[model samples]
Target chain A: MDLKVEHEMHKRRFSRNAGLGFVLVGLVVLVFGITIVKVRMIGNVPEAYNAAAGLPTAEAGE
Target chain B: MSDMSADKSITSGFENEAGFSDYYALLKPRVMSLVVFTAFVGLMVAPVPVHPFLAFVSILFIALGGGASGALNMWYDHDIDAKMKRTMNRPIPAGKVTKEEAFGLGCALSGISCILLALTANIFAGLFLAFTIFFYVVIYTMWLKRLTPQNIVIGGAAGAFPPMIGWAVATGGVSIESVLMFMITFMWTPPHFWSLALFTKTDYADADVPMLTVTHGREATRKHIFAYTLPLAVVTLGIAATSIGGWSYLIVSIILNALFIRGGWQILRRDDAAAEADDYKAERSYFKLSLLYLFLHFSALLLEAALKSFGWGGF
Candidate 1:
């Protein structure tokens, strides 16, 4: 009976730790996903860069 | 007998006081989601490639910054939140957490996030993060929120800076792409928020928030939404046409813009009486759709970048 009670307590502790672990993992994944999205969309392209740099464009605003 | 039972229930509510989960509820998860999405989009689109570990740190700090802003906003707006039905059950208003605790948490998190960003990333990114926290907490929450109908319009800049910050984290400098991304969010804010304001005008009125709908009427708000959305569609298409975006993105942009414009037009065409009659379901649907629209648009950009990196497409 003593051994069985100890085993149950260990299992409960393991389960609680596992739940906390999952929360930490979820938060990390959420942050990583956000980072990946932001990294994919920075800087001007060749066409727009040229237009902005005034590369003899006839377009009045350009 | 009924009065005694009601009194007992009320007393039991205090006896069984809510806990941490209730306090967490005040962070406004929906607004946080947009902050997360735009900030992520900024980090992804930058020219610089950050190491996986540092990337993780930067994004974590950004999320903390966003949460800190939300906490500070809640702390300051507790009184107004108490009066609004939508916000009545928030941590401060619901008496789950004291305003002082919220303020302290917000300040601590803000400082920690900014310092962490500076340590892990570049100074420019750190400065941007610090500014974003200051702008949201001071300029928006403390000043603009109750003072002007253009609260969202001007205050939206705070929310718009995250992508640029992300870009700076990667590149260690600002560029046109970051500015464009900033513009996209800046323009989208008014229309997205005004739609909610249209549906919840009474809540703003009760809180004395000078939202466009409350100050200028629903018709004017709708017109402004349409006006902003038209230019927004143009900008979205323009960004897609640029080198960073490819064919896949252009296709997605066209489709998304069409849907966005349609939603904006529907909002504009509906009269106030018609909108109010159906509990502003049309306006609410448009608002929800706008959220997904931005997510899908940015995801498409990510997809394009991935495809290009694999040498699957031409620039």
Candidate 2:
């Protein structure tokens, strides 16, 4: 009975720590995903802005 | 009977043996994430465009610099970490990694990041990176952490520098936008961190670290939290109004600041007994919320910049 209780407590502790780890990893992924998406999306805007300003787009070939 | 008990103890202890994951915990990846995001925002908002290759290099160096600071912070605080329940499981105290290893990793990464920044970007950005490492490792970790309750208030400047470094990487010089980015972070650090300190007073006190809660008492810390938070909200909104940010950012800023102020006000109203009774759950939740608040605010700025470039609403 004592052995079983000890094992159960250990399992609980492990699960708790693992849960915290998952939460942290989730937060990191959320921030990283947002950053990458925003960067890629915004990255092309400068070119579009230039094009709209009547300047030849850099990739449009001279 | 005795032999059986001994075997049981040994096996149980082995089961709890910590490893690399524990060491990684000491690096404070969540804080590092904010540093990287804000730095990326600064890089994106700069007037000059950096080559994609160079931008990648700059962000990489900034992240490494952040990790180096974390490792060094753990190395210096290992003694206290052992005492604090919150930090007692950290690698050094838990015997997962040696202090020497952490120190070596910190030193190696710091040197590599600084030199790489100089090579890939400009000397100005590299210099800022080196100064940030020095400030966090030497000034904050070695000196201020043990010496004063105000350690984080000043030490927080180290984390605030990444955006400036990112800006420098792009423009090769500092400008008002970079300064505004720095100001937003500089003001935000005190309230965000001190709230955690307020809730974790026992751990800090046990560790012999003079956090505000330990030095000034919970009531005083609560007052200070609200005080710093008011200015922080103002700075956050102020940054949104600048040329680097636009309407989407301003709207996000206003909403986030209102929520942050409400949280801070809630913290101020709670007494030490009430805070302790809830296991500091309120403060902990608020701290978590603050992290998301800053991330969203910066992300909004990036969104606004994108909107402007597409000939949409620039204001």
Candidate 3:
């Protein structure tokens, strides 16, 4: 009698849908983390490029 | 849920069929890359410098906004894609992705990108992102794409909005410099896409889409190509006189414009028999060159910015 092991039989398995879901989950998590940071307003005030008159400065624009 | 899986063609094949790459295609990565680069340049040459981490996050959301536009465009244009030979192999037409899945993906990403942008950047940048997405989907894709030969003309405004959105990321307001960049892309769109129309007019004709070439014939389209490129050159030279331009920028602009004009002339001189015999090679070459043309112009502008940073006479 000859028999194949269950682990051997499943060695090459791959599921595209699951892989896609995993990738999407990772992306969503990344985006979510960035959103939290931005929402909390945790960063330095950006510096203006020019010191000219008659235009909206960075802070004023914000 | 059972009904969704049962209809397989219209629903997400989340258990098996839809692969990672299929989802990626829905984002239109090629278009997204252009959005990212242009947005990055907009931020880089802006009148303010964002915090480094904030800058990265801002561009990431901008890219997501661009991807959302692509997904929504693909969702709406699936039928048009099915009819056109050039687009027939896209995810939806090829059965690799479903319309409902694409639609949901687009809506989700659009909200995520915009909300996060507002939270991270300023409300102006976030609102700009939201408006760009709305314009591309509602105004451009749903309304203009199939209604008129002038569709791409008006629709091009959606594409031109990215740099302005990017500029807002840093400065939180519009400027003449940002508007000039937007104009550069806006004016370039018709001729760039029309060059494509000259050779692939049959594709638009077959799909019942009113591209300029399909509506006006090749002669009229050829004339439009030269007409548009001339003004594009003028707009490009005008931008060179701005603070962002430099000696190197001027040199690149002149050479590119000369070649562009010659390319347009080549298309104008082609007869039906000649175009058919040569497989529209000249027109196709012009189309390919037009792609490089915008990229090089933007890259030259960035180079000017870098040189100016080093006190090399950009202003």
- lDDT string for model 2 (A1-62, tens) is 23434554466567658866885695466447545654775678879888899878889846
- The per-model DockQ list reads 0.03, 0.05, 0.15
> Per-residue lDDT tens digits of candidate 3, residues B113-171?
99888877789999999999999999989988889898988878888888898889999
lDDT of each: 0.79, 0.80, 0.83
Q: After superposition, how far is residue B141 of candidate 2 from its true place, in Å?
A: 0.8
Question: What class would a CAPRI assessor give candidate 2's docking?
Answer: incorrect
- Highest-scoring model, TM-score: 3
Candidate 1 off by > 4 Å: A1-62, B1-18, B276-281
Q: What C-alpha lDDT, on a 0 to 100 scale, does residue B191 get in candidate 2? A: 85
Per-residue alpha-carbon lDDT of candidate 2 for residues B1-315, written as tens digits (9 for 90 to 100): 676586577566555454446656656788788778888888887878877756876797788788888988888888988998877877888886778889887888789778877866789998899899899888888888888999878777878888898889898888877887888778788888888777653677666778887788779988988898898887888876677877788888888889888899999999979987989887988899888887897788788767867876446
Cα displacement (Å) at residue B154, model 2? 1.7
Task: Sort candidate 1 into its docking category.
Answer: incorrect
TM-score of chain B of each: 0.89, 0.87, 0.91
Q: Candidate 2 local accuracy as lDDT?
A: 0.80
* Per-residue lDDT value at B231 in model 2: 89
Worst lDDT run of 10 residues, candidate 2 chain B, spans B14-23
Q: Clashing pairs in model 2?
A: none
Q: Give the number of the best model, judged by DockQ.
A: 3
Please state the CAPRI-style docking class of candidate 3: incorrect
Give the per-residue lDDT of model 1 (tens digit) for B1-315. 475565565555454254444445555677777777777777876657787777767887887888889999999999999999888888888787789989997898888788878867878888889999899989988988899899998777888888888888898888777787788888888999888878863677878888787788779999999898999888778877666677888888899889889999999999989987998888998899888877887788778767877886435
